[model samples]
Target: MISYVSRRLGTSLVLTVLVSMITFFLLSNSFDGVVRSILGTAATSATVQAKKAEMGMDRPVIVQYADWLFHAVRGDFGISYFTGQPVGTAVADHLTVTLSVVVTALLITTAISVVLGVLAASRGGVIDRLAQGASLFGYIVPNLLLAIGLVVVLAVELDWLPATGYTPFTENPGRWAASIVIPVIALTVGGVANLSAQIRGAMIGELRKDYVRTLRTRGLSPGSIVLRHALRNAAGPAFTVLSLEFIGMLGGALIIENVFALPGIGSYSFSAALQGDVPIIMGLSLFGVLFVVGVNLVVDVVNGWLNPKARIQ
Candidate 1:
């Protein structure tokens, strides 16, 4: 297990570095524009050149990347070209809002998917058909459309929740929950659609194995057999689906945040891109890559725990 974890960790670190390097180079290609955006178009050519030298853009791309990476390791992501805010501070502030919604949606997705998947797999009739049908609808509908419909029904028409704008949880937990509900629902529908289907299929396969018949022959209760053995065996695939869902949710949050008027990393990144704020864009890229790598690591560890054979693999 220790070796498995070490290997996964090493691989994650390498991937993170590679992603950062690629992102840095890609964004560096537009450094002249970023500098001009920072210094303003009215600035003279010498002024722009001076700004580039001051910011070390005059150096080779590799050296600039190494310097940025060095500072980034210490949590200093430089300053935003437009806002003049520290990149780390800006990203961190918005990241909390994004995480609050995305993480809540993930928890809800997992619970609902598990219940629906287990029931559909075990019951195999009307319940199964209904679960599959619901999953199909969710899969087909885009999150943006779902979010708009939800806002119209739940907020504008019914007035059950806020239509837009975020309230910090520190200010009012209740309002914070209200602010995120529509966004979370929008994010969760597709995740549940994908994960529940995967879980149902995996559970069905697990339940058909010879060991399940033996467990029944030995008089194990249906619930006990399903929960203890079949579910545990099926969890590996579910976790894989969940990891993919998390990555998807992060991307979805970008659009959902804008739709709901939530001040999240998604909105921040979008504005940064429009303004050609390279530092903030690079900071967001690093955070996203690291976030994904970390989640993948967690999923691997959980898979290993649920299936010892996974550790060897």
Candidate 2:
């Protein structure tokens, strides 16, 4: 297991570095052009040159990427051009708000998916049809639509919840939870729908295996057969879906955040891109790359443990 983890970690680190380099170089190159287009006739060549030098854009792409990577290793994510604050510090301040909604969404998604998936697989007639219909609705509707619909019905018409903004849990946990509840629901609904469908598919596939027939002949309780025997075998695919969903929650979801006015890394990245804040954009992209790589590594390790045969392969 240790060997497996180490190998996967090494590979993930390399991928993270590559992603960071690509992101840095692309952003650095685009920054000048974007800034130029916006500045146009008002900008002088000398002023632009000076700005480039100041932003370290005068350096080669490799050197710029290396410098950023070095500072990142030391937990210095550079200063935000817009805010004049440490990028890491700004991200740290907002992480709690983002995580509150994301974690809640993940938990809800996982719990609801497991129950609905198992039920759908166990009962193939009306129950399966109902589960399929619900999953389809959640899967087919885009998150932006979901967010807008939720805000309209729940916040505008019903006045049951706030439509936007984040409150720190430290101040008032109840209100903080209340504020993010809609966002969480919007985020998790799609994930739960996808996960449940995958779980149902895996379960159905596992049920067709000869071993399941043998278990039935052994007179094992139907519950034990499904939960203990079938579920263990069916979980591999569902696990992948869960991992990808978690990684996605951390990085993207900008549309949802924008629609709901939720303060998160997603909105920060969006703003950074819009303003051509090279440093912040690079920093956020690097952070996202690391997060995704780390999540993938963890998923690989978990999958390895769950199926020892995979380790041998």
Candidate 3:
């Protein structure tokens, strides 16, 4: 386990560094534009030069990356071009909302998918067909379309939830849930569909395996045979699918955040990109990449425990 963790950690570091390098270079292409955004279009040549020098933009791209990486490794991700606050501080402020949305969506998706999938697999008739139909609808529909439809129906027509804006849970729990409900549902639709299909298939396969029959013959109840024996075996791959869906949710949150006007990383990232706030953009982008990588590592660790054959050398 130690060896596996060490290897994954090393790989994650290498991948993160490479991603940071690429992000730096890509942002460098707009280095001049960022300066313009900072100083505005009317600045004199001397002013531009001074501003560039002040922000250390005059350095070679390689040196700037090294400096940024060094600071980043030390938890100093630099100051935002627009906010003027530390980039880490700015992200930290909005991180809570984004995390809350994704985490809520993940739990909801998991609960619904597992219930539907297991029921479909065990029953394998009308329930199975209904589950499949729902899965297809969710898997195929575009998130933007669904989000808009939801906002219009739930917020405009039904008058149950707000269409836009956010309410921090700390301030008002009921309002917080009301505000986030639409966006979370929109973000998790595909996740629920995909995960349910995976779980259904995994459970069916596990049910067909010889061990299931042995357990059944051993006088275990049907629910126990399925839930205890079949579900546990099915969970490893379902969990992997869920983790990948989580990464998808993170990416999807960007769009949902914008759609709902929530003050989360998605909104923050979109604004930063529009204004060419290099520090904020870099910080948000790297945060997302690392988040995905971290989730995958956790999944790998879990899989190793579940299936010992997957253990690292």
Best by lDDT: 1
Best-to-worst order by TM-score is 3, 1, 2
Lowest summed-lDDT stretch of 10 residues in model 2? 32-41
RMSD per prediction, one decimal?
A: 1.6, 2.3, 1.2
Q: Which stretches of candidate 3 lie over 4 Å from their true place?
A: none
Which window of 10 residues has the lowest lDDT sum in candidate 1?
31-40
lDDT for every model? Answer: 0.92, 0.83, 0.91
lDDT by residue (tens digit), candidate 2, 41-69: 58988877777787777888888888888
**Which has the better TM-score: candidate 1, or candidate 2?**
1
State every prediction's TM-score relative to the real structure: 0.95, 0.91, 0.97
At residue 182, what lDDT does model 3 achieve?
Answer: 93
Instruction: Indicate the residue-level lDDT of 250 in model 2.
Output: 67
TM-score (C-alpha, index-matched) for candidate 1: 0.95
**What are the per-residue Cα lDDT tens digits for candidate 1 across 173-228?**
99999999999999999999999999999999999999999999999999999999
- State which candidate, 1 or 3, has the greater lDDT: 1
- As a TM-score, model 3 comes out at 0.97
In candidate 2, the residue pairs with backbone N, CA or C atoms under 3 Å apart (3 or more residues apart, or in different chains) clash, namely: none
